[model samples]
Target chain A: MQNENLYKELLRRFRLKVTLTRLHVLDVLANTPVALSHADITEQLAEYDIDKVTLYRTLNAFTKCGLAHKVATEDRNWLYALHMPDDAPSEVTSDHAHFVCDECERIYCLPMETGNNTRDIKEEQGFVIRSQEYRLHGTCPECHTQFSQQ
Target chain B: MQNENLYKELLRRFRLKVTLTRLHVLDVLANTPVALSHADITEQLAEYDIDKVTLYRTLNAFTKCGLAHKVATEDRNWLYALHMPDDAPSEVTSDHAHFVCDECERIYCLPMETGNNTRDIKEEQGFVIRSQEYRLHGTCPECHTQFSQQ
Candidate 1:
C-alpha cells in the first residue's frame, strides 16, 4: 500500500484523526515487515522532525485504538506494528504469535493454530477488558539450519 | 510461608543477600494472591522506605533469577508474581489465560490446556529470539456467573 492510503485507512479503522506525525509513524511500521520498538521507531524518525513525546503519544494512541499492538522483545522494550488487517477484525490477527530470529534481532508476526483463545473467560473485576496479545519465540527455519551448520 | 522464610529462600535462590526491602516486597506479593503491576506493588510498599526504582530493579532481579516471572495484564503495565508449581519450566504455562473483572478491575491468572508449541512455524526475518510469553485475556468463572444472573 502507498504511504497516503495506509495513513488514511489507519485513521478510519482506528476512528482517530491522522496527523502528519501519526502518519509517519504508521508509514514506518506499514513499510517494514518486522516489528519496531519505541526506540527503533524514534531512531528511524530522527530525520522526520518528530518529537520524542509526540512519538510516544502516537504509539500509545495506536495501541489503544487498535491501529497497532505492543510486541514484547527479549530486551524487554515494547515494540509495535501496523495491525490493520484486510478482511477480518483486528482481533483475528491480533491474537497471534510472534517469531524472533535467533541470529538477527528482527521480529516477525506468525499466525498459527495455538489453541489460544479467551472468549470463554469472563471479567471478574469492573475494568472493561478489551484485548490480548501472544508471542512465540524460536529460531526461524533459516536460522535453525544456519545454527545447525555451524 | 512467613515473611522471613520467603525472604531468606528468595535470597538463597537468587544468590543475593536478604535485604529489608526485598523481604518487604516479597511479603506484599505473597499476601497478594494474584499478579500485581509495579504501581500496585509500590503502593503496597508505601509504608516502607522502598524507592520505585529499587522496586523495579528488585523485581527485574527476581524475574531474571527465576524466583518470579512477569505476567501480562490487560493493562499495558507489566505484572509480576511468584512462579507457581503448575507453572513448571517443562511446558509453556505462559500460554495460560488471565481474567480481568469488568466490575472489580482485579486480574486473575487462570490455567488452561497447553497451547501449540511454535517450533514448527516457517521462519520469517532473522531476529534472534531467546524466549516466549503468551497470555490470554477474559473473565473469570465467578464473574461469568454474576453477569449471567444480572
Candidate 2:
C-alpha cells in the first residue's frame, strides 16, 4: 500500500532500518491525534503480536532520531506522538503547549502564543534553550461537561 | 531545633502526622534551591537510614497535600520541590516555569511572566485549567561554560 511505502520512506529519512514493527508503530503514532503511553501503543498493536520489549525499543529509537517525541504525564509516565513535519506552520512539531486533563489524564496539543517564547530569558540568562514544553493541567471540555453533570 | 518545630507545624497544618523521616525530607527540600529527585533526597537522608518505600510514600503524601510539587524532567522521572508558603508574592509556589539542563540534567525554577497566564484560553476554550508547568530544555550556564571551554 501507499501508506506502507510512506512509512518506509520516513524510517529511511530518520536513518532507521526498515522493520515491520517499526512501520506498524509509526502507523499507530501517525494515526493517533492525542499522545499515547507505552501501554496504549502496545494495546493498539495487539493484532501485530509485537513483543513488548521490541515495541519499547522501536519507540526509543524513533524518539532518538527525532521521528517522535515523548510528553511526560502527571503519573510519571511518558506519552509518545509522531512529529508533523509535513504540516507547514504546524505548531504540533514546533513549540507548543499540551493540555493534560486531570480527570481523564488525556494529553491534547495546544498552539502556544509566539509572544511567550523563551528568547528573552535565553538571552538574558545566557542559557542555550533548544526546546520547550508547556504543560497545562486542567479538565478538558469533555471532562468539564461530565463533571458539571455529576 | 526550631527548624524541627517549624516542620512539625507544617505537617500539622496539612493534617499529616509528624514523623522523623518526613521532617528530614521536608528539611532537605526546604534547603534545596533546585528541584531534586527521589534518589537525591534519599542520598541526602542516608544518615537517617530511611527505607525507600517509606520515602516514596512520604513524598506521595507531601505532593497530595500541596506541601510539595513534582516537575517532570526530559527523562521520564520527576524532581520534587517544596512549596514556599511564607514568601509573599513568591513565584516558587505559584505558576512558574522550570528550566531543565540537557547536559547536567539539573532543574532550575524560573519565574514566569504573569502576562502569559492561561486565563485567556480558559475563558475562550472553556477548559478549567488548575495548574500550568512550563519546562524549557537547554544547557545550563555551568554546562554551557564547560562545553565552550572544552
| Global Cα RMSD, each model | 4.8, 3.4
**Candidate 1 lDDT, A60-137, residue by residue in tens:** 888887778777665667788777777544652346566666566677865545443334333333323454545556
Chain A in model 2: its TM-score? 0.82
Query: Can you write out model 2's per-residue Cα lDDT over A12-33, one digit (the tens) per residue?
Result: 8777999989988888888866
**Candidate 2 lDDT, tens digit per residue, B3-113?**
999889889887799999999999999886789999999999889999999998999888877788888776778789887566332332356688888888989877665
lDDT values, one for every candidate: 0.66, 0.79
- DockQ, per-model, please? 0.35, 0.63
Against the true structure, whose TM-score is highest? Answer: 2
Candidate 2 has an lDDT of 0.79
Segments in model 2 whose C-alpha atoms lie over 4 Å from true places:
A87-96, A117-119, A148-150, B87-94, B117-123, B148-150
